[model samples]
Target: MTTRRTFMKGLAGGLAFCSCGMLDAASAQHHAPRRLPVMVSGKRIRTVDVHAHCLFHESLELMGDAVARILPPTKGQQEHFIVVENRLRSMDAMGIDMQVLSINPYWYGKDRDLSAKIVQINNEKLAELCASHPDRFAAFASLSLHHPDLAVQELEDAIKKKGLKGAAIGANVGGVDFANPKFHPVLAKAEELGATLFIHPYRLGELASRFKGNGWLANVVGNPLDTTIALQKLIFEGVLDKFPKLKVLSAHGGGYLPSYAPRSDHACFVSPQNCDPTIQLKKKPTEYLNQLYFDSLVFTPEALRHLVAQVGASQIMLGTDQPIPWEEHPVDHVFATESLNDSQKAAILGKNAAHLLDLKFS
Candidate 1:
């Protein structure tokens, strides 16, 4: 089988050969780094990013000056959020054919009416962006999941009325983890709707003291650590067992869980008395690892390889925590990973996400 990386290298060679005879120096340079079209099994392979973000500018404007004051922009935040042109350029340069844009929930604390407005505005703007640039973007809905009832309605509106892909939720809302039985209705609704539930981490509030000095470990270590714990809670608490078909995508490479799942499997076996007997699950902890989808944002090829080994190729998708410089060259990252074959590379780069999002390309 012609692997995706080999096929791309072959395509690049052909492009170089043709450009050498036909184009001038500047023209060749202009097209030099542009990604050549890739095909696998007679279908064009696109690079669909599962972990990209955009700030809700219109929603913020609706929130007015007071809320904006507290949520002041970070460096390059304006261009990253408000400026679509720059975003497109960056995508093209990185060979990302489409981005699944999501905005982290910041309205969890707002009043019901105000929070509803925020969800409405965010969904509408996201729908508009996807409509305007069909090829470049699709978005996950921003829901006030803290209010499960409202979140159910908001999710329905986003998918049914606004045509969103799904909802982006924080791992925990006001310190309430998803494993809590109270959140089951929302999870059931998502499964009923067949919507992909993306779980991103909120700020690690528990580590405020440790992260006070510098280095932003709160975001670095805290983000994945929080996600790991949240996912484990869901698994051990039998949330996965309850909603077997739930298509959950965990950000930050499943936040150290997949890589360290053996520990979990051992915990139950090594010390059955130490484990919770009431929270019985159908399978071992490691068995649920492959049931979830993860992004390739671990920053190194070895880490990605380990994740794939643990979770399988079809469960891993291309995710560049874009505009944040976490995993900048997403396509390059997948292609350069020697551990993966062409089919695995193709699946991670786009096929898995295309199936997950139900994206059809001509």
Candidate 2:
């Protein structure tokens, strides 16, 4: 080298040129990182659909005759079994990373023994599926709330032995409200065990009869109404107050409670005796809404926006209610909403769910 500075500068210039050339080569070979196909923000985000249903082959086999008996002989509801496979395919097509499956609560009838058998069979298959497709499926175990002791035993076996993520219970089980004292043991067990209880609505009962005519009216309108009533019963009746550790998730965006919680508080203020004395909620009815989580299956962007605002983005998890006639595209719905930023959307779509399920993204 003639001089150190001159040689160093020359070498630096050559290295810079080489680096630029490499950058150009890399740019030519690769496109800018594509955003995840569906996200609240146009960034690469993985999504988890929390409120998906998966019909086990055995469940379908058990219910096949029942399904046929219920359906119109002309149209044939037997074909509905395809809905399960179709839902799984749709999740794959939409880039949904994981689906937390639960059998719809309607199948849990008034028969305690039959319900227990059904739950055991369904959960066994669900556990098997999770084992086989460790990457794709997780599940919430269904319990036979018709028998509280049996349910508690099942909960222990499911969570401690079978390794289920959580348990799914209906808004009302065998005509007993979730807030009823009869269910206290189950709730206590769930809370003590740190289990997530996903509450869904059953199709028939006194509440369903209120809708009249076809049960579809009850399912469409009364289902969400039942959810609201059940949750309020839990809150006002002191179930939540007593068991703060219980992780209760209300389906269909927590029904109408998020929107009309003020009425409940006002009623309580007017007549404290009407509400359960055991509850010691320090805030308004709406305030406790944050304690529960909601799924993003509200159907419209406006409804979702309101729900997100009420519950905040972190408490909102993605739910599709897959394999059901009323299922919606929660991933696309979240992505299409312009109200939320990248981070908020990411939390709702998958991050929140991942945290809840204690999953690791590879």
Candidate 3:
């Protein structure tokens, strides 16, 4: 495995000279003297990226040396996850004030003991990162949902003791959906604790055979598809109904479901047989869409506008799947969108997330 010293040497060796302004901009955002609540448009906007990621060196070491080979390389051949310099540079360039980091745990298939250890390592690192850089970084805890009881305890500790913002979870636990009664204990605990659940895709294992292509359709289509399915299960099965106070911030613009949610409402009306008779709902499926939240990672001004039109602006927050080069200029994306007014843009950029995350700017 590459040590931090070795990686820093590589960063210096292969890197070409950049403008001092850019370097200072990256270094200054966190360290520079400034008032709190980060003003924008002559008002306190406080831009926050609800979706960002990092990798801890200790966690990687625990996974062993061969695992490091699969990690993606950043622009300067730096390890994308372990190196913080590029992340800070990108955040500075994007004008993001604070980023909420999550690990998106890869230990779902590991044995319970190993998975628990991974969760502990990830949460501890996340806490340390947030503690060290309180201005620029906050984080969600990693959970081993296969063991729901353990997950509940871990989440409680992460929020109450470690000061993590919440928990980031895959769309499903193994093949089981979030709507499963078995998972309700964890969900109840999250709702009870007022934890924000960041639902990211696990990659579609069921669609593997059909997703064969050069375009990475498995992710392009399958990632959103998994999120869509997971969300539908929550909606159609009344999981959201059971926990109306639960704060769920869906990744990838709440998958394709928000844009296509009206179809779900129509389905139950047109094809009663297809709808589960046992599962009764008080509101239309699309109505439940408003009760949820989404990220502005749709990648187009028009797409962002449509999402706002579908679910209203207050339910959306800024999310850049950073370190992946997806939606690189998320702040600019919101600004370029013509449909949203200044107030709506401000809310999506930060205020909404501040309320959900209970962030208190100092």
In terms of TM-score, the best-performing candidate is: 3
Q: How well does model 2 score by local distance difference test?
A: 0.71
**Lowest lDDT 10-residue stretch of candidate 1:** 15-24
**Per model, how many backbone clashes are there?**
2, 0, 0
Q: Candidate 1, residues 76-101: lDDT per residue as tens digits? A: 33333545777877777667889999
Q: What is the TM-score of each candidate against the true structure?
A: 0.86, 0.80, 0.87
lDDT of 1 at 285: 88
Stretches of candidate 1 above 4 Å error?
Answer: 1-43, 62-75
Q: Order the candidates by TM-score, highest first — what do you get?
A: 3, 1, 2
lDDT of each: 0.79, 0.71, 0.80
Alpha-carbon deviation at 46 in model 2, angstroms? 2.3
Tens digits of per-residue lDDT for model 3, 164-282: 88899999888788789988988999999999999999857777999997887877898899999999999999999899998888899999998788889888888889888988987
lDDT of 2 by residue, 266-337 (tens): 887798787767666766777778888888878766788889888889889888665443433456567556
- Candidate achieving higher TM-score, 2 or 3: 3
The per-residue C-alpha lDDT of model 2 at residue 341 equals 79
lDDT of 1: 0.79
